[model samples]
Target: MRILMAGVSGFLGTRLVDLLVADGHQVTRLVRRPPRGPHERQWTPSAAQLDPALVAEADAVVNLAGAGVGDRRWTDQYKQLIRSSRVDATSTLAITIAGLSEADRPEVLLNASAIGWYGNTGDRVVEEDAPPGEGFLADVARVWEAATRPAEDAGVRVVRLRTGLPLHRDGGLLKPQLLPFKLGIAGRLGSGRQWIPWISMSDWLRAVMFLLARADLSGPVNLVGPAPVTNAEFTRELARQLRRPAIIPIPGLALKAVLGGFAQEALTSTRVLPGVLNRAAFSFRLPDLPTALHAALHD
Candidate 1:
């Protein structure tokens, strides 16, 4: 399979490309900066390229482009940047691809989304059919997914992957978890009862490829572990892996004081479920919390 990727430099994008290439797939990256490698193609999000010939030649287009949710301090300007970055970039990609000749468009447009769309569901079990949750992140994700509907309407199979915390040591959730545990400060966040829907790095990408291969799989599919863990439980397991004591859970207000608006995201509940994947008989290599925590920290 030939795959075109946007935002190839991101955490998930970088890993997903590696997995796809190792699976012996031809990969092309649409990048913002100067083209760096043999497979890199340059395109600006503001003035994106829209060559039909380029669009039609690929088997699939995997879009993982966007501003990082956890990276910046959420000043008013920064919030706008976050919203504009994802909404504009994704809209451009989808509309451009949709403009291609019907024969030239890729079979699949696997767009990246987030479980944040469900907002703070408390303990509610979130599935693909669940309505969009409220607040900033949820609003951003709703618009982001809506941007891709045009591509789906144009006879291309569009899959919005509502990905959760991808547990990997190299970047993302693993790094922060490490610092706290190393200093013996690792503890549950907020009330500790908030469900933290997460997935192993391996399983997350594997399922993406699975969706790409299966013609029937389209729309939103929650990319989270089948066995979701609460923050308290997740904290205990993480500390267990590092051989540390995970007591004295952090207060939500304290987190809000420190992280401001972003605290709600890291400390609140999502409780997403991969219902479609389970019903389709997909099996996870890292099915439980302890084993996944071990791989993330040790291996």
Candidate 2:
């Protein structure tokens, strides 16, 4: 398959592109710089523009493009940038795909979203059909999902990947979790009872490929571990995996004091399950938190 992806330079994008390429698929990277590999292109998402001729030549379009939510401070402007970067890039893709001639258009569009769409639901079994939660993160995810309307309406199989925390040592949630866990100071974020939806790097990659290859699957699919562990459980597992003492509990007030609105996401429970993946006959490589944490920490 000839696959085109925007933001292939990001954490998940880079891994997804690597897997796609390794699987012998021809990947066209949409980057900000000049072409560097077998397939490379350029685009500026903030401006809502891309080379149409380039976009028109693809079997599938996987949009992993977006600004990182955790990369910036929770300032109003940064928050808007986070929302616009995703919504705009997706809007651009959907619109461009809609503009394509029938014969030249891509067959499927696997767009990236977040599990944050469910917000802080404590222990509730949220699925694709669940009503979106309310708040800043939820708002960002809502608009992100809406961005793909044009593509879906144009008859493209649009799959919104509501991703969970990916366990990658080089980057992602693991990087931040490392220092505290390694130093034996890691504890539950707040009370640690908040459900932290997560997926191993291996499972994340495999599940994405599963989604890409499947024909009947579309709409919102949660890219989360089937076993949604609580923050306390996560802390204990991670500490045990790293041979550290899980002490030093950080209260909700401290988290809020330090990170403000961002702290709510960390302190609240998003008890999400991989309802779509399981029903679609997909299997996870690392289904347990202990094993996944060990591999992530060891690597």
Model 1 lDDT on a 0 to 1 scale: 0.86
Q: Estimate, for each residue in 1-299, the C-alpha lDDT of model 1 and write its tens digit.
A: 98888878898988889999999999988888888889988777766554555567798999989888888767788888888878777887788788988878899999989998999999888799999999899999999999997788899999999999989888887786787787887688877898988899889988998999999988999999999989888888887777888776788898888778888788778888999899878889998888887788767
Q: Cα miss at 220, model 1 (Å)? A: 0.4
Q: Cα RMSD to native, each candidate?
A: 1.3, 1.3
The Cα local distance difference test for each model comes to 0.86, 0.87
TM-score of each: 0.96, 0.97
Q: How many backbone collisions does model 2 have?
A: 1
